[model samples]
Target: MSSQAPPIVDDEECRPQISFFQWPDYVVLALMLLVSAAIGIFFGIQARRQKASTDDILVGGRQMATFPMAMSLLASFMSAVTLLGNPAEMYNYGTQFVVIGVGYIMVSPVTAYVFMPVYHRLALTSAYEYLEMRFNKWVRLIGCVIFTLHMITYLPIVVYAPALALNQVTGLDTYAAVSIIFAVCIFYTSVGGIKAVIWTDTFQVLMMFAGMMAVVFKGTVDVGGADFVWQKTVESGRAEFFNMNTDPRERHSFWTMTVGGSFLWIATYAASQAQIQRFLTVPTEKQAVRAIWINCIGLVALLLVCCWGGLVMYANYFDCDPLISGKVKASDQLLPLFVMDTMGSLPGMPGLFTAGIFSGSLSTVSTGLSSLAAITLKDFLIGAFKMELKDSRQASLAKWISLIYGIICFGIVFLVAQIGGVLQAALSVNGMVGGPILGLFSLGILIPWVNWKGAFSGGIVGLVFVGWMGFGAQVEAALGNLSYPKKLLSVAGCNCTTGVLPAPPLPGSYPDIFPLYAVSYMWYAPIGWCITTLIGIAVSWMTKFNDPREMDKRLFSPVLIAIMDKLPLSWQEKVNWPLKPAKKEGCENSGFEFEAENEKVQKSEDENTHKF
Candidate 1:
């Protein structure tokens, strides 16, 4: 087979070409940079003055308010994926992308009630620290390792999505755009700490909202109106917005999204270290719960706006398809094409959209970089190396780690080109690690008898199975054998006079037959979680290895304890707490007598409480 590029179809001839930005767009770019920098510097000064300890730097000294926390969560989750990819997804696949919001809405309660209390009670700096207290040091280490790997693979793509938008508008190369954006993000995150990240995220969220709203409003006006757009979309059969039936094979059925997909959102928002770390910034669990609700509402609103933007694109092009216009070869390029072509003559509009895209990208990248640094320093470095640092030294280490990870993430952005659609690629990569991580965390929280042996074995097995399933699906899809639907092209606009495009050659090593791709991406989380938890529990029960006494009482949910009580004594004994007599008088204080020669245990507790 020849390695030449595929021949362009006649319809592709009308595709809008993007040229270099003119003067007004440059002014907009300059203003955006200046504002972003100002936000960074202001936060940095505040962080330096207020932060005296590692906690202050990593989690805002555990004193953030609901609005800031909600905004940070919104910004972190939105990312360039939502800004750029959502519109693209909508343009390509209609309103199916909106299904993501369904899962997100249902998952918030899980974060507020189930996950928030455990992390707050423990006063954990990193979510993985819970694993250590609940199971063993090895379990914590595995969780950290998986989280780090996921972020490393995931963060670069976050950077790349916006860079694609900026590249289209400004004619800048992807690598250069990625570097500039990463630098700005690192500067803000390193200087301002979590406070800066949250406050800046709040601002960026506005930018993102404004940019999308601009596209929606102007695009609608230009296309005649909302009614016209709706009619056109319905006529085109792209208005099938709701799918109420249950179909495991269908990607965006209402049942799958609300049930199975909710698990994925819960895994990320509630259990993922990156998100949990954000919630830890709040002063009280009440504030954290409030923040979770705020985030949920905000996310739903944002998703509606995103879906609206998609409808705007379809409506604007109702009479003239961009594909028919030859403005772009792929549906993924439709949104950018619409902006550049329809609004090109209008000054600074392109720049605003581009800025919004970058805002989303930067928000996510900064959070990922900061979280990776904190996790690396606290979970892996301190635990594995048996090294301890004072508050001052730990804070310094965190700053430097953030800087280093920024560079590494910038490097990884190049590989994002290999992935097809931004949303699908992001979710696919996330699921491979997220499923196992969620399984491990569930094992720790809900199953008291999961010993280190079972936990470790279960985690590894879960990771391998999830990876195989996710990657196998990707391979099948690439080969066009998967049941997932491809974008349909209209034959009316085609020019058959040109020789039919030669069939793309098959890979030398192809699967003999396409396996049934019944499992939707949304179900990956629940399926993986079920597999891992069941395997862990069964294996632990068979081995009778975990000593319940070793498990921390605080980590077990009431439901978990009920299950533990029902197990046989031999199994229960292995994992149950041993009985002990109450401490007498000064004996509890004997261990720490160096501070005070013969203080009573109650006195010591009183003194310690008073000191704090």
Candidate 2:
């Protein structure tokens, strides 16, 4: 961190403002939209030719290729919120935020080894089906309902972000742009299904990379070079690389990024229907595992590019902050403002950038719509109501369901537009429910003792606990009683006649509140996971624990089972694992009555043992 404030430097050539959103930009943007729609149409034709089944419509018939699957998984969650909000995060916070990439790295193995194997073996359309298998239908419905609500709240924010960018650079009506984007997404997603969503996502991910790299490349060159950008950022106290603080209330620390952040990613990859459906699209577990690693690599690369774009923005505005000078209305608009300032004059550059932002939103919404359809059909229509239908009818119903969800998402966009600081707001909302959802899945996989009663109780408690803290923090932030201080800003070279905005108050100056409310949003997932797991185990013990010998091994995580197999014989005996099969008493079944019914049709003990 530098001690000297940035000097007042009157430099005109360096701060040239150019009008963007011209004909060339429009052509480039229109090209992306057409290509995305075309992909959906092509896949729709292919599906019709083959007379695709519900499996084909929802999960690509469980035979999708690896590369596209990997890209779709990456694009689905890393939405415009990621592309537009992350650069702003870097600009407002600092490099300490980059440690979140490490969280992505940690998620790969956890998903591949733990969650993937269980889901792959089950081969269910809805990931929530595992909850029912482990507990009962009520648990599965709870998971489905949570996911539906999550996507409803989340998709609107994803769509609104790029619309905000267009409003900033092109003066486009935000809701109008959102409507157009959602219409295209709904058309392709409903027509082409998962195949169309995955292919379009692959194309959009390419656009994302191209657009982000173009900004980074042009911004670095325009700002004098990478070296100058680094120097300026360091001098302005914005090149923060390491903050080892362990305090939960301290935002963007190494501990929060790796530990708490890993929990966030784990919840996303392990439990979220959007990612799980993509994982099941591939032919085998190995391909899904490979795709997870590939997605991790791409994600890290994209994060680095977005982070560097922030540094480049800082370098260009080192002596004149845009927000302080009233050049940009919101932090989320800083990237678009920088794009227009630097690359606006270049033919198609601004359009290419806008296309990339829209691509992120498109991939996300399409995936959400597809996943929502699957959850509705598999978990609710079939699992809850026991509806039976032909494969073609099921596919038709799914498309209609997806169309309805798209419209619902469009309506939610108006609400999301009112929220500020998209990156944190998005993450905070995700963590509030995401933690408990992950905890529910984790309980089923790791704790054989947990019954339906315990699982349901723990999930409800975790959701309430995290929701209380997350919403309280948001209210405090809304009221301006709490905020993380941003990196220093300067308006020394402002050419406009606006008053300088005051620096944010330090964390110490924040109003007192419940300590839990002050905890960083990063910890929400871990906190939810812990509360659910502990309470679930305690409740199960107090009621009726599952008989280890009677429980199905496939429901347990392979990693846990493998570790137990290698444990000392005495330790295994103590846990009552690999024990002699006891004759079942008619009323002594696990509180999971679903499992009890399954016992009658289950395979022989030797067959089950051999399968494990």
Highest lDDT: which candidate?
2
Q: Which lDDT tens digits does candidate 1 get at residues 216-267? A: 8888888888898888667655665567756456666666667766777888
Where does candidate 1 stray beyond 4 Å? 1-16, 241-247, 323-326, 486-518, 545-551, 558-612
Q: Residue 515 in model 2: shift from native, Å?
A: 1.9
TM-scores of the models, in the order given: 0.85, 0.91
TM for candidate 2 is: 0.91
Residue 259 error for model 2, in Å? 0.9
RMSD (Å) per prediction: 6.5, 5.1
| Model 1 lowest lDDT segment of ten | 589-598
lDDT of 2 at 559: 92
Residue-pair clashes, model 1: 12
Q: For model 2, what is the alpha-carbon lDDT of residue 75?
A: 97
Error of 1 at 271 (Å): 1.3
* lDDT, residue 110, model 2: 97
Please give the distance, in angstroms, between residue 455's alpha carbon in candidate 1 and its true position after superposition: 1.7
